[model samples]
Target: MKISNETIIEMYEKMVKIRKFETRAMNLFAEGQVGGFVHLYIGEEAVATGACESLRDDDYITSTHRGHGHILAKGGDMKYMMAELFGKETGYCKGKGGSMHIADATKGILGANGIVGAGHNIATGAGLGIQYKGTDQVCACFFGDASTNQSTFHEGLNLASTWKLPVVFICENNGYGISVSQARHQNITDISQRAVSYNIPGITVDGNDVFAVFEAVQEAVARARKGQGPTLIECKTYRWRGHFEGDPTVYRPEGELEQWKKKDPIPRVEKYILDNQVMTQAEMDKLNEKIDALVEEAVDFALASKFPDISSAVEDVYTDIVEEGRSR
Candidate 1:
C-alpha cells in the first residue's frame, strides 16, 4: 500500500515529538527534576512512529524500560507521561510507577515494564486475549535487541506461534544492553533469523528509515489481523544516550556515536519531506514551532502538578488483596 503525504507529515511530527521529549527528559534528569532511572529514546524514534502508525487505537502494544517513545507513538498523553516522570499525582500510574512503568489501558498500552524482556509475556498474553475473543485485534511487542536473549522472548514466540496468535515482535536493535555491545553479548548477527525456529516470518530493516519500517509493519499487521500469526521484525538502530541518565557511556567506541548520529532518523525524514515537496520548509517550520509549544506546555503541566501523597504508595498495588487487614 502506498503511504499518503498526510501520513508522512504525521510521521514527521511524531519523530520530532520523540526527539524533543527525550531531549527535555535528559535535561530534566540532569537537574534532578525526574526521580528514578530514565532510559531515553533519543535515536530510535522512527521505529516506534512507523510501527505504531500501522496500528489501530483498539490494537495493543507492550513496551519496555526504554518505552516513552512507544507509548507516545501509540497516543499516550504527554501531560500524563511528564507528570509520571515528575512523580506527581497527575501521572498515568498516579505517580508511583515512574519512568519504566507508565501505562494507559484505554490506549491499549499494557505498560512500560522495568524488568528486561518482560513485555514479551504481556504481549503474548494480549495476543491470546485477541484470539480468545475472536477479534481481529493484534498486539505489537516492542523490546531491545538484548532482551531477545531472555527466556521470556523464546517462550513468548513459541506460544504465539503455537497458537497462531496475532502478535508482532519488534526488536529495536540499538546494539547495546546497558554497557554491553551486541557483538560482545550475543552470538547471532541477525536476531530476526530466530523466528525461523518457530515457523514465522522474520525480517530486518533500517530502523532509521520510517517508510521502510511502516511498510514492513503494515504488512505484518495486516497478516496478523487476518489471523496469519506472528512476525518478528528487527529494527537496526542505535541509542544516542547511555543506558540510563547517570551512567558514563565510555564503553561506546570513539566516533561510533557520531557515525550513528549522521544517520539520525529525524533529519532523514525531514530531508525526504522537503525533497519530495510533500511539504515546504515553511510548513515544516510551522510544525516545529507547534511541537515546541506542545512540549513546553507538557513540561509546564508536569511542573505545576502536585507530588503524590505519602499515604497513596500502596493504593494501586493489588486488585483483590487488602493491605494488612485494610478494606479491599
Candidate 2:
C-alpha cells in the first residue's frame, strides 16, 4: 500500500520525536533531573512509528517498558510525559507512576508495563472490549523478544485466537532479552512462528524499514476490522542502549552494536523522505526546529511544574479506598 506523502512526513516527524525524547531522557536521567530507570528506544524507532501510524485515535495499544516511542507515536503529549518522568503533579499518573507506567487513557494508550510480557493480556482485553462493542478498533501489543517466552503470551494469544479478538501482536525482536541473546535463550529463529499454535497469521519483517512495518500492519488491521482474528508481527530490530540506561551490555558480541547501528531507522527514513522529495530540505529543517523547540518546551514545563502534594500519594491507588488516618 502506498502511504500518502503527508502521512510519510508525519511518520518521519514521529520517529524524530521518539529519538529526540529518548535522547533527552537519557541525559535527564543521568543528570538526576528525572528519577527511576529509563530504557532508551534509540534504534527501534521505525517499528512503533510504522505500527502506530496505521492506527486511529480511538485505537488502543499496550506498550512495553521501552515505550516512550510508542506513546509519542500514538499522540501522547510530550509535556505530560516529561512531567511524569520528572515526578511532578502535572504528570499522567500525577507523579505516582514513573517512566515505565506512563498512561494516557484518552489517547487509547493503556500503559507501559515494567513487567515482562504483561501487556499481552491487557492488549487482548482491549481487543475483547472492541469486539464486544462491535467497533472496528484494534489493539497493537508491543513487546520485546524476551516476552514471547512468558505464559501470558501463550494464554493471551490462545484466548484472542479462540474469540477472534482484533489484537495485533507486535514483537520487537531486538536480539536481546535484558542481557540474554535470542540464541542463548530460545531455540526458535523467528518469534512469529509462535502464532502458528494460535492459527493466526504470523510474519517477520525488517523493523528498521517503516514502510514494511506499515504495510504489514495495514494488512493485519484490515483483516482484523473484517473480524478475521489476530496477527503476529515480529520486527527484527536492535536496541542501541543496554537494557536500561546504565547497563554496560558486556554480553553483546564484539562489533555487534556497530553492525546494527548501520541499520539505524531514522537516517534511512530521512533518506527516503529526501529521495522522494516528500518535503524540501528547508521544510525538513523547519520540522526539526519545531520538534526541538517542542522537546525543550516539554523540559521547561516539567521543570516548572510543582510536585504532587503529600496527600495525593494515597489518592489514586484504589478506586474508592481511603487512608484511615490521613485527612485531605
Candidate 3:
C-alpha cells in the first residue's frame, strides 16, 4: 500500500489534466466548436484517475459515454482527443469516432461506448480472452449506476464470476441516470450490494477521495492478476455538469449541484497534497500552469488540423468491402 511520491504526483497531474480538459471542452461546446453530444467529466475526476493509476499500460479498460476522463487517465494523448472532439482527421478514430467512441488498442482502451452498459460485456469478453491466453492481465470496466439496470450488467458479471474472468467492474454512481435521480431509478442505495448475487467481493468507497479509490481498485486489480476472479467497486461520486452539454438539469433539486461542488474531487486532492506536504505550493502552481498550457495547446492543434476528406469516408468503415466488390 506504499505509493511512491512519483505515482502520487502523476495521479495529481492526471486529475488536474482531466479537469482542465473538461473545462475547456465545456467552453468549446458552448462556442459551437465541438459537434455531437458531449459529456463532461468535471466533478468525477478522482474515480477515473485513481482507477486507471492502479492499472498497467497493458491492462484493458472499457469506457462509458462520459469517457474523456477515463481515456486521459489511461495515458491517452490530449492532442488526438482534442482533434477528435473537433472532428479532425488526425483524431484517434480518424475523425469518425468523436467524443463517445474514441479507442486506442495499444493502450488497452477498448473504446468508449455510446450505448449505456455496453462496456460490461466488452470487458467481460476481454477478460475471457486474457483467461484463455493465461496472461496475468485484467480488464477494468467503467460504467454509471444506471447501467447496472441494463441486462448486460447482470449477464457480464454473472459470466465473469462463474468463469473466474479477470475483470474489475467499477461503477461510478453519480446519483443520476440523466435527469432521473438514483432514488427514482433504483430501490437500493448502494450499488455494490448487487455483487452478492454474483458471489464476488464488492465494496463502496468515497469517489471524491483519490487515495481511497486508488487503494480499492489497486487491491481489486491485484486479486484479478492472481486469477482470483472479478470484483465490483462502487464509487459514490457526483457529476457537476448535466448528463451532457446543454442539459438544463431541471430535475435536480435547488442547490444540489452546489452541495456536490463542495466535495469537488480536484480541490480535495489539491488540499491533500498541500496538507501532506507532497508538493510545495509553488510546485503545485507550476504544475497547474503547465497542464493549462497543455490543454490550450491541444485546442490549438485540433483547430489547426484538417477535417477528413469526404471521399475517404468509406475507407476505414468496412474491412471486407474491397474483397466483396472484387468478387462481384
Candidate 4:
C-alpha cells in the first residue's frame, strides 16, 4: 500500500498523541487519579501508529496492557480513555477495567488484555467471525516479547494458520517483559522466526520506523483479506517508562534505558515528516498544539467525570441470572 502525504501526516499526529497521552497519564498516576498497572508507551509509538494506519476502521485489533497507543491509534475516544484510566463513571468500562482493560468494541478494538497472550485467542476468534460472515475485516493482536513464550501464543498461531483465519499477530518486542529481558526468556533472537513452526510467514521490522511497520502490516492485511493465513510480525521497539508506576526497575542494566530513550519514535516520525516535506515544521507545530489542547480537554473531562456508584456493585455483575423487573 502506497502511503500518501496525508497518511504520513496522520501517522505523525497519532504518534505525537500517544506520547502526550502517556506522559500526561503518568502525571495523573502521580496525582492519584489514574489507577491499576500503568504501562506507558513512550518510546514505542511508531509500532502502533504504523500498523494501525494500515488497517481499516472496521478491522479488529486486540491490545496489550501497554495499550493506550494501540487504542488511540485505532480510533478510540480520548476523553473516554482518560476517564477509564481515571476510573471514572464515564470510562469505557464504567470505572471497572482500568488501565489494562480499556476497549471500544464498536471501533474494532476487541480489548486490551491484562493476562499475557490471552488476546491472541481473542483475535483468532474475531478472525473466524469475520471469515464466517464473509467480511474482509482482519484481526490484529498486539502483544509483548514475553508473551511469545506463552503456550496460547503457539496455540493461537497454529489454530489461525490451520484454519487460514485472517489474523496478524504483532509482537511488540520492547526488550523486557515486566523486568525479564528477551535474552533471558527466549533462546531464539527474533520471535518472528517462530512463524516457521506454524508454516506462516514471519518478518522482523524496525519498530522504531513507522513507515517500515506501515508497509509491512499493509501487505499482511492484504494477504489476510485474500485468504492467506496469519503472519507473525516481531517489532523491535522500546519503552521509556518503568513497567508500571512505582516499579524500581532494578532488572534494567545501567545505561540501557537511556540508550533506548535516544531512539524515541516521536522524534523519528517528526524527522520523517520534515524531511519528506509531508508537512512543514509550522504545520507540524500547529498539529502538536491542537493535539495538546485536545489532550488537556480530555484530562479535564475525566477529572470532572463522576466515579461509578458503589450501590451498583452487583447490578451489572449478574444481570443474566437476576430478574428483569428489578429497579435501580
Local distance difference test, per candidate? 0.94, 0.93, 0.95, 0.90
TM-score per candidate: 0.97, 0.98, 0.97, 0.96
For model 1, residues 1-328, the per-residue Cα lDDT tens digits are: 6789999999999999989988998999999888799999999999999999999999999999999999999999888999999989999988888999999999999999988999898899999999999999999999999999999999999999999999999999999999999998899989999999999999999999999999999999999999999999999999999999988999999999999999999999999999999999999999999888888899999999999867686566688654543454
Query: Looking at model 2, which ten-residue stretch has the lowest summed lDDT?
Result: 319-328
Task: Please provide, for model 2 over 27-129, each residue's C-alpha lDDT reduced to its tens digit, 9 standing for 90 to 100.
Answer: 9988878878898899999999999988999999999999899999999999999999999999888998889898999999999999999999999999999
Best by TM-score: 2
Q: Estimate the TM-score for candidate 1.
A: 0.97
Candidate 4: clashing pairs of residues: none
Instruction: Name the runs in model 1 displaced over 4 angstroms.
Output: 320-328
On a 0 to 100 scale, what is the lDDT of residue 271 in model 2? 88
**Model 4, CA-based lDDT:** 0.90
Clashes of each: 0, 0, 0, 0
Which is the leading candidate under lDDT?
A: 3
Please report the TM-score between candidate 2 and the true structure: 0.98
Number of clashing residue pairs, candidate 1: 0
